[model samples]
Target: MITIPREIKEFIELQGIFAVGTTGVNNIPNISPRIFFRVDENVIYWLDFFKHKSYKNIQANPWVTISVFNKDDLKGFQFRGIVNFITDEPTKLEIKESIIKKTLEKNSSEKIKKLSEKIEVQVIRFEPKVCYSLNPDEFSDMCIGSDVDSTQLFQK
Candidate 1:
């Protein structure tokens, strides 16, 4: 498992949403915007509100790439990882509460309720194997660490 650098960890945790990419057959990928997501120290979790294409793809292939980039600057980190579903009801409930809190901060109560109702509530726990910087130059200036390749954070 790859240890997340502090700078990258803080940057990711501030994100309200993420782009989750899952590959289909022939290595084609489907990328989707997932609003209900969180980045932890060593893992990332996002609620699959619907059992959509990404969910199906995860079932077939656990490997996924998740990214959160600045719309203006296009600077961020992308992580590649293996994911497994969080089946425990307790953890799922906790995640729900956290999501509700986070969502409520920036959304109306009615909207939050509507969003909550639509949730299939499938929580995915991603254990990242790599953390690649979006820009090598900017990444260096951040002075995060010497260990990160800034190009490729992991070895196959």
Candidate 2:
């Protein structure tokens, strides 16, 4: 299991949306934008609100990938792993709290507030099997893998 670093976690928190990728048994890929997501230790969880395609895809194939980036800085992290749908009370409570917290933040729309209350959100958890950093310094744009000690990748 790989542990997410503090800097990466902080960067993710500052972002408004995350891109999640999943593929079905037929190998058709699906990407979706997610807002209600939280990372804890080695697990990353996101709330799925009426995402029928994503829900169906994950059910067919457990493997998934997540791409997170700060467009302004042009830096990002890509994570690949296995995913599971969790409907446990504790995780559901966490998702509810996240929705409440985001609603309290600036520029939250009435639609978002209403959706939070009405929708049946599913908590999807991702356990990272490997991580890669998208670095553009090289001509080919090298992607450093975290399977080996990820500390080396963080050390500048």
Which candidate comes out best when scored by lDDT?
A: 2
Number of the top-ranking candidate, with TM-score as the measure: 2
- Point out the worst 10-residue segment of candidate 1 by lDDT: 140-149
How high is the lDDT of residue 80 in model 2?
78
For model 1, residues 58-143, the per-residue Cα lDDT tens digits are 99889898877776666788777889999989998897678667766766668656877774678889888766677645652342
Which runs in model 2 stand beyond 4 Å of their true positions? 103-107, 138-156
Task: Go through the candidates in order and give each one's C-alpha lDDT.
Answer: 0.74, 0.76
User: Candidate 2's residue-wise lDDT over 1-156, tens digit each?
Assistant: 688888888777788678999888777889998777778778888878785888999999887889988777888888877899887888677766775576448337888666667557787889887777754543223434445454453345
TM-score of each: 0.78, 0.82
Model 1: how far is 71 from its true place, Å? 3.1
